[model samples]
Target: MRGFSLLDSSGLPVAKTCFDPANIPEALHLDVWRQASRCGAQVDSLQRDWRFRGRTSNWYTDGVVFSHTLCDATHYQRTPRHIRRGDSDCLVLKLQLAGHQQGIFGDFDHFSSPPGTLVLQDWAIPYNITTTPYEVMAVSIPRYLLRGSHLMYRRNPVITWQPDSPQARLLVPILTQTLKSLATASAGEADAYAAGITGLLDGLLLGDRELLQSKYRERDRLEDMRQYLSRHLSDPDLGADHLCRQFHCSRATVYRLFQREGGIATFILRQRLQRCMQEISRMGVVQKGFLEALAHTWGFSSRANLARHFKAYYGITPQQAVEAARSHQNEGQREMNAPYWRDAHRVSRWLESIAPGASPTEPAGAHGGTRQGPRELAGH
Candidate 1:
């Protein structure tokens, strides 16, 4: 695939391309795969042995991109930084095949995706995905395509559709067949397939778009308030009153929006407490008084205040939490010098190696292990 005429045998500019991790050295396998999966998405190896096999057959056609990817154990994350609100927006759809992907995606916390689930993601929202060695078919559609049907782009960035639903039975097959068609179809045919999929999708979306519009409008406002609380956790005036003015909503309205989260005060407390916990997990209370310091920084009056709420929320005391974190930290310290995790320069080079670039013949890909990248990641 390194011949780099965009890697399409037909030389189509809106070309189909593929990536395999084997083109690079074994040590940088995870790094390059992360780079190609989604720009800025962080990839972590679940296993120290790194049974990493990420092969992607991707096609760009008519405002949509379809990809079929299979991989081994890995954790992928797109954090807040990947939420590009003003950019050319995209919604990614993941139709699970052989394996399950479980993680927190936007507001849907602690989700375990089942097989045949269609997960739609707004690129503006962050997601964390951990997958087993499994097969997945994904489609990336631009936001404008849905806008034609009155779908709110940012309302539900992460939403799952079960395959057994009435709507899913109708829409899921079209989505699946159209995405798979990209692998074998030529440029003209693939583009038409993509357009056809989008058209049919728009019709389905149109049926519900009008109904979801207002519901999403309310969700968007709630999301805005949540974002505000995250950025201003330490601010003294960070409560329902502040949110009311900041977002120009009534006190009653603010309460109504967060009714599911136990009202405005609880949401703020949870955000502050969440950050405090993350700090403890990452650093494990380095100093004697760091626990109190962490509490104060997050607006807790004292260590006792944080401990009381933390125990209520997580069923553990602050000291106990630190002890657990320390245990995990000590375990990771052993791998701090391991070869598979070493050599930043080599990883950078391999990450840089993914150019707009395979042979065309591996029905299973070029070599063993699904496919190979650069030289061998060709679309057959």
Candidate 2:
């Protein structure tokens, strides 16, 4: 494993690194820092209206990789201008959690990856960024580690990926959720997070590498069953018995597999309605005629059926949900073209008393400074 270091409470690199910075070419440092700065500024602009200000950052490695953050007006221009790229390369995966950004990675390759979009790029390359109103979670890993993996090296070098398929979908949600959890993580959790990341990366590349062979085989069978049902949602005959015969599985086993998602018949109906609703949402609420026809066409069986299920799941009737979704859609579009939107600054003051050094009895306020409320100091 590559040598590593971490941050203490003071947020400083606490280990003696092995990588020699003096050997790095001077030109590369300036270029990397320039892009880092622009990326930092773009994120800061997005978080300007929030109650929170500034971010905590740490940079350390045995010269294998570097990581840092520039929050609280800590712009990227302050980074050193020279770096050695021989022993290792750097890849930065930026997750924009709040705002949107337009960036150009290579001369002709432009990206408009919005909030929830993950951007991957090489740090050795020159990149430019366009700012918007939002913050980001950025991860910088050594290129050598990633490139050494047979999986990553084999894939298209400049591909942008999304978690869409059943097998691949877990990657997106898990990664995003982990990143968010990391923001407030304690020192003890850092190593665990790092291990989880590496394992996940390997699984992503090698296709669920951590699972037992039996589990992997089961997943494949389940995935096939799912796809078959999805493709034939309208068939009333699409029940457990059909699945048992098609997959050569026992009726009990088939029923058990789908039990978690409701029985096989209920699951099929749910999927059909969900698909129909997705199409309706895309067409807009005003397309009332098309919407009704689509429900029946998608195997809802009747308008009442659609309405009942839609309300049960979405808390709104089909017509009302469509209207509400349209309103939400229009609002989102309006915000996109604008420079910024107002963020709600309604942070609860009760957070102060519970801050870092606060006593258990204290009513605490959080999100930076100024503790308020009855204070009973702990660990004093």
Candidate 3:
């Protein structure tokens, strides 16, 4: 029996692995169990007609982001005893491309998913999933990425998106296209797309006014704080007091929102350093006093301070990064002149078009340094 093969955008098989119960008579159930366990969950009980077919394509993103396509015959999967040990603490955003499924999610909530419907299932919870001959495309995202979003705090076992709502109407197609596009997307492109997906989910969660009004004020406050920070990243005076004044929130709330990244001050410092690095990388070889000016622009106290922090964060001084950028400038220009680069440039422009407030111009010096680095494309 030929096994499943993961294909690239060019339709070439990047990975292939076969699992057939027929091939191994000694362990008829081993093949299916292997598939289930290796992925995330466990197949608690397999029906007599149980058959499994699955393929996974992982995209290069900030965390464990991947698309798993499966066509399974009849099966029941659960998170039991030792099964729970493998919990990934991730969320599976399953899009029913074909067929249907019904399951008890989050212990109490039951859901039926049909074609075009989107369902979000948290891997941290105990649940049972039952499906017939069904085909599904599921994107697995790390839960922490959605930590501050209201959806992450929802008690619902599974959040399902029907085609009826305005949000679903807009979200479903974007997700479907994103899943389809990942096959061809470069690592840098995939990172950008993954961020787009996260932004969409955040919007979906925040758009639910009823849910937000229930008891999610803290989540809203966090979201607001994040937006304020983004806009004020270059503000040297930005701090807990500024956040408190702008958002009318306490200093504790400001600290809590940024706790995962460090404290509020640390988060701000990191952001400034990141911006400085980007600016330095883009300018390549800078003119006299350029470093000092860039540092001030990004809110660094001084060029020396920026250089120290930049070296610590990126393992190279800002001057080294500028020199590297200059060295690769010609090569980047030649690559940008290529057909593929033109295509990529057009795609980047299109992305910026769709994302309001996104800069249409490619970041300066992006052409030279590690062309497809995730961190490089992350700013795009």
Candidate 4:
């Protein structure tokens, strides 16, 4: 179903509405509406005759922030002043899909993104970006799920674009192909597909040294702090103060990081729920009855409350999440055999032919292992 509305974190509708494009000017686009359509987004052809032409960006999510986007022929100049903040803080990555873009990061350094390239930015920063009517695909992942101890974009705050990095080259094609596949997927396939794409993107950004070393250090610190909390979820006293002591950070520091989340109490509860869902999912096929016990095991005092919140965050009941996890796991159980593992051999030979000097590390076939999807990734 195609629709348009702006929503807060609570998922409440609070905005002017436009469904049929005729009522709304082609130049005004809303984030939720653009996400729903799974195409590139643009607000274009204004009364003053300014043009903002970009396709709707594709996205999929399970709450707690994960999204992928593909922008085709995106050109937004003479954009109104009021819309500037909206465009900046959306907290999305921009991978150059095609064409060329040039801008200034600071005084000394200028940046340009050519086709088959990638760049990073946080809405928190002030910078300029422009593209010359090209195709670009990118993912907007929540800072929470990324693994490791570096703040990639926070300091550097930008990756202009690199066409030659082995990682960047591998990513552009994979993302392009994945977005193509996602266009035709069933609802059940959407989340996992989104997950895989997010994983690939995180790996690329986290894998880059410039991203990790300077700008993004605080972000990396917070992620490490969260993972440390997750490892201790079984403790009865697990909460914000405990985390503060464990990380030896100030209450102010902790509070600032989690301010948007209400407080530490809420953050801990959400993490516990996420971990419990992961555990239940690994159990494979199971009845909904198992969830009550699972909730209890996860330290929820009431099944009713747990179910309500879980469904709200995941867009599925805990029972449904379990079922999806089982189906996801079972699908992989069959894909792990030796014959299936051989698929990488063909991919390696294919890669070798196209880019003779492109071998960075040993191909997956050399390790003789199956390709696991994102669901199976170990929590940090």
What RMSD, rounded to one decimal, does every model reach?
10.7, 19.2, 20.9, 20.4
Q: Which stretches of candidate 4 lie over 4 Å from their true place?
A: 1-57, 63-91, 104-110, 148-150, 210-380
The candidate that achieves the highest lDDT relative to the unseen native structure: 1
Which portions of model 3 miss their true places by more than 4 Å?
Answer: 1-33, 44-49, 52-60, 80-86, 148-154, 212-380
Q: Please provide, for model 4 over 126-231, each residue's C-alpha lDDT reduced to its tens digit, 9 standing for 90 to 100.
A: 3333344455566554333334212433345455556687766776676666566655544334455546655666566656656446434475677677667667
The stretch of ten residues in a row with the least summed lDDT in candidate 3 is 351-360
Ranking by lDDT: 1, 3, 4, 2
Among all windows of 10 consecutive residues in model 1, the one with the lowest summed lDDT is: 356-365
- Per-residue lDDT of candidate 3, residues 185-248 (tens digit): 5555655666777767755655664754553446566656755775787777888998889878
Off by over 4 Å in 1: 1-14, 20-25, 38-40, 84-88, 105-112, 148-150, 210-380
Distance from true position, residue 121, model 4, in Å? 1.9
Instruction: At residue 94, give the lDDT of candidate 3.
Output: 80
Number of the predicted model whose TM-score against the real structure is largest: 1
Task: Give per-model TM-scores.
Answer: 0.55, 0.38, 0.46, 0.38
TM-score of 4: 0.38
